[model samples]
Target: MILAETLLFALALIDCGAILFLLIYYIITLSDLECDYLNAQECCEKLNYWLLPKYIAHSFITFLLLFHGQILLFMLNLPMFIWTTFEYFTVPRGNLGAYDPTEINNRGQLKKHLRDVMIYIGYYLIFFFIYLYSFILALLKGDPIRRGSDDDIVTEI
Candidate 1:
């Protein structure tokens, strides 16, 4: 059980680390105030490539959590899941309509943004529930209770 707990903690740490890294990367991408239309497209493409490793890491962590039944491991996996879901929706993808802006005007852009927002929000909700379910299961198991205590039991007269 101790070994299992340690492994679960390690996996969770890795998972959280990956999420922090990805969050930093996203922040860096957004920090560039000069990011324009083309820049946004390029950033999105680059992000897509970068996300592959993160996806794999997340999947691996989830696998460990499920197989090991480590609540800590599942807890570690939750942030990455949430962040990725958020990223998927918020990351700007080019317009779905014709590449040319002339064909798709303000209304089209608004619609596209709305669609992306909805998709992201929906997915986030789904993943959130999944994480919550796993977390609750883990919590129910409770932490490994320590075996020994030094306290003395006294009888009152």
Candidate 2:
């Protein structure tokens, strides 16, 4: 249990860290005028480069959770893994014409918007369920096991 807890904690930390890094990168990219000036092909290449590490980190977290023998964590991780994988596949990449951003009124733009909405819904639903489950587990189990804690103690004076 201790080992599993430690591994989960580490995975959680990695996931959280990767999330922060991605957020920061996203903010930086959005803040830059150079990004807007870049051609569609260049932008896609740059974006993919930024996304690759985040994909790896998310995958690692999911793998850890799946193998850790905890039912709740495993359930929580599976959807997240799938969502990220979906995003990776759906995301526009390289110099392909598929990636060119059209006007909001265009049919392609509407399709993209719908896809984004569905992905957001899926991600959020999974996240909410994971939190609810974890909260219930915490209530039932008191707290997760920690390393180097005294599980058994005897004192005599």
Candidate 3:
């Protein structure tokens, strides 16, 4: 139980930190996106839908952990694992907020979009295991094990 909880907490914190970084990166990219083929509005909407929710969901899960909301934690994490599974396949198809495929007319553009999709998906995929481990720990724990423990939490300067 201790090891599992330790791993769960560590990974969850790491994932949340990485998510914050990603949110910043996505915001920078959205503003800096070349507006030749992709509409900036569309890119913003995609960020709102995809990247923003990731930040929210990850943060909410961390809150759930801090307060020891086991049931809610399990519930929220289950769907995310499932969603990540699907994203593993769909992301390669320009389905990950890259411009629509039909919009790309030439080979160079197609390659560039594919490379973009791969980079986004590749970096993001590392966190899927964190989510997976969390879901499993929450499921197995079945109740709050760390409900009263605040000793492990670290405060920044």
Candidate 4:
């Protein structure tokens, strides 16, 4: 149980780090697109590079929590995972898993995408906090490993 909790914490930590990176990247790219500093297709392509790995990491953590019997955590994360996964699969593909800039006018797509990214960042922040809480609880309650009794301790002399 401790092992599972520890692993879950570690994986969640890594995934959260990736989410932070994506948040930054999205903000910058979206700003650049707004200013006409970057081409829409090129910007989307760069963002697309990270999408698959993000999806994979999210799914792995969700499933790990489920299989480890962390029911509450699993339940909390399941809805978002399912919603994002469905969005990922259902979106039109020619744009490379990103919103097609031409589909919306007045920079609406960019603004909407940025808003969505922020929401996901917020969700991840809460999710990470929950994982951290569980990990700390496990550590506090876990028993220390004992290799041998006190009699087996070797004296410095």
Candidate 5:
């Protein structure tokens, strides 16, 4: 139980870190796009670099949670995992995969992407809090196994 808790805590920590980094990157990209500092193709290309790793990490976390019988926790993140996985497969890879580069303007697409990122950022923040609470509760509860004591002594014939 302790092992499982520890592993879950570690994985959640890593996931939270990834979520933070992603949130920052997304925000920067959105700002740059809005300010005309970064072109649509460049934004997509930069974000492309993060897509696969985020998907892989999310999948691993979901798998680990399922393996450990964390059904509730697993369910909470299932939709996000499924959505990301689906996107990973359906979306084109590399430059301009997320948007049509030939389009005269990508402002609308960038706005939509920003909204999606904000939603994910909120979801991940909530999930991180839940994971932190679970870890703390597990620590407080402690192990079920009692420490060694002089209770029943073995007798030799």
Candidate 6:
């Protein structure tokens, strides 16, 4: 069905946009942590190794779709990308000290720590769901998320 195909195509575009948005944000956030907080440049290398390729792939898919005249879907990504970029520039960085007795003793500091951790987790989840839902929608639309996923489709349903 054309509707299903459109949904599949849209999911792919959103997945691409989501990753691009989060990849930029995460890289900046982690880099800030490594540079200004941790002072350990090597700390985020593994994450970069794992994510850089995916980011590239997402970019490629989004751009290709855009070039092919998917204007609305591509346009939808602009606000997210802009917001993420804005957040990267505006968010503050702090020292990454571990296990300070004063921090635990102060309830306010504890709350702040909790809030920051929750926010970081939230950022991860936001894009994670985009990736997840894209795959799910793809499968539901009878499209393959990957090469091996094709065989799992049931047409009679």
Candidate order by lDDT, highest to lowest? 5, 4, 2, 3, 1, 6
Q: Cα lDDT for residue 87, model 2?
A: 67
For all candidates, the clash counts are 0, 0, 0, 0, 0, 0
* Candidate 5 residue lDDT tens string, 1-157: 3256866876786787787678789789877877989886787677777888778888888888888888999899899998987877785554355444544154476677778888888888888888888878766677555555779554532
Tell me which of candidates 1 and 5 scores higher on TM-score. 5
For model 6, residues 1-157, the per-residue Cα lDDT tens digits are 3245445466564655665465465455454543465433333343334344543554555565466565675565555445434533443444222323323334664345345445644644555565456557655775443344566765553
Error of 1 at 58 (Å): 1.6
Ranking by TM-score: 5, 4, 2, 1, 3, 6
Worst 10 residues of 2 by lDDT: 96-105
Give candidate 2's whole-model lDDT: 0.53
- Measured with C-alpha atoms, the lDDT of residue 131 in candidate 2 is 48
TM-scores for all candidates: the values are 0.44, 0.53, 0.36, 0.79, 0.80, 0.33
- The root-mean-square deviation over C-alpha atoms between each candidate and the true structure, in angstroms, is 8.9, 7.1, 12.7, 4.1, 5.9, 10.9
Which candidate number has the best lDDT?
Answer: 5
lDDT per model vs. reference: 0.51, 0.53, 0.53, 0.75, 0.75, 0.49
By summed lDDT, the worst window of 10 consecutive residues in model 5 runs over 95-104
Q: What lDDT score is found at residue 73 in candidate 3?
A: 56
Q: What lDDT tens digits, residue by residue, belong to model 3 across residues 6-88?
A: 56566675675566566565545544555344564555455436644564555555455545545565565555545544543
| Candidate 5's TM-score | 0.80
- Residue 115 miss distance in model 6 (angstroms): 11
Between the candidate structures 1 and 2, which one is better when assessed by lDDT? 2
In model 2, where do residues sit more than 4 Å from their true spots?
1-4, 31-41, 90-157
Q: Which stretches in model 1 have alpha-carbon errors above 4 Å? A: 1-3, 33-38, 71-157
